[model samples]
Target: MHILVDRITEKTGLDPEKVEPAVGIMLNFIAKNSTREEVETLLEAFPAAEGFLAIDEATENKGLFGGLASKMNASVGVLAALNEMTTLGLTVEDIQKVAKETVEYTREKAGPEFTDEIVARVPGLAEIT
Candidate 1:
């Protein structure tokens, strides 16, 4: 995870702290929209993924409106994740860079087959990443 974060930080010029949350948001979006089996494979390939998801969950559930926001996230899909990332001070371009780097990191950790399947399965993900 450190290695991946370093790579994204170096390549995207995003803050180190922002990288994890951005990546986590993208991963959570993917998980929510893709097949369970494919997502499981992704989690297996990136075991630290669970930690990232947990962090995102904790961050999302932090305030009075957190619970409601989380529920809205479920119903709203990628928009919710995008909103979360933006709240972390990321722009659309930053988000795309993070998504691309994350997918590339997953490919390196897993394989093209595993990464490709998830990206293809998740609608609009191809365009974003």
Candidate 2:
């Protein structure tokens, strides 16, 4: 997980701390939308992925300018995840880079088929580029 974060940080030029939450929120969105079998396969492939999806009180507190995001009716998806990453001062291009790095890394670790299934299932995920 840290390796993924590191790669995204380096690729996107975002801070490591900022990258963590971004990764968490994105992973949370992906896991939430994935089928049970898909989620199980992803978890089996990357044990630390569950940790990335876990949102603590601290992370929840940071949502949408100190939790305003929770007040809004926003479903976790590619757009929502991009909004979260943008709040961390990332441009759309940066967000795209992060998305690319994330997908590529997951493909490497979890296999291309699993990664492709995830991207295909998540709404607007293919548009990240």
Ten residues in sequence with the least summed lDDT for candidate 1? 61-70
CA lDDT of every candidate: 0.78, 0.71
For model 1, residues 1-129, the per-residue Cα lDDT tens digits are 577789999997899898988877777777777677877887888898888777776777433344453466444556667677888888899999999998998999889988888788666688779
Where does candidate 2 clash, by residue pair?
none
Best by TM-score: 1
Residue pairs in steric clash, candidate 1?
none
Error of 2 at 120 (Å): 1.7
Quality of model 2 by C-alpha lDDT: 0.71
Where is model 2 poorest over a 10-residue stretch in terms of lDDT?
A: 68-77
Candidate 2 per-residue lDDT, tens place, 52-114, comes to: 877422454443444543454334445556777777777788777777787787788789988
Q: Predicted candidate 2: what Cα RMSD to the true structure?
A: 3.2
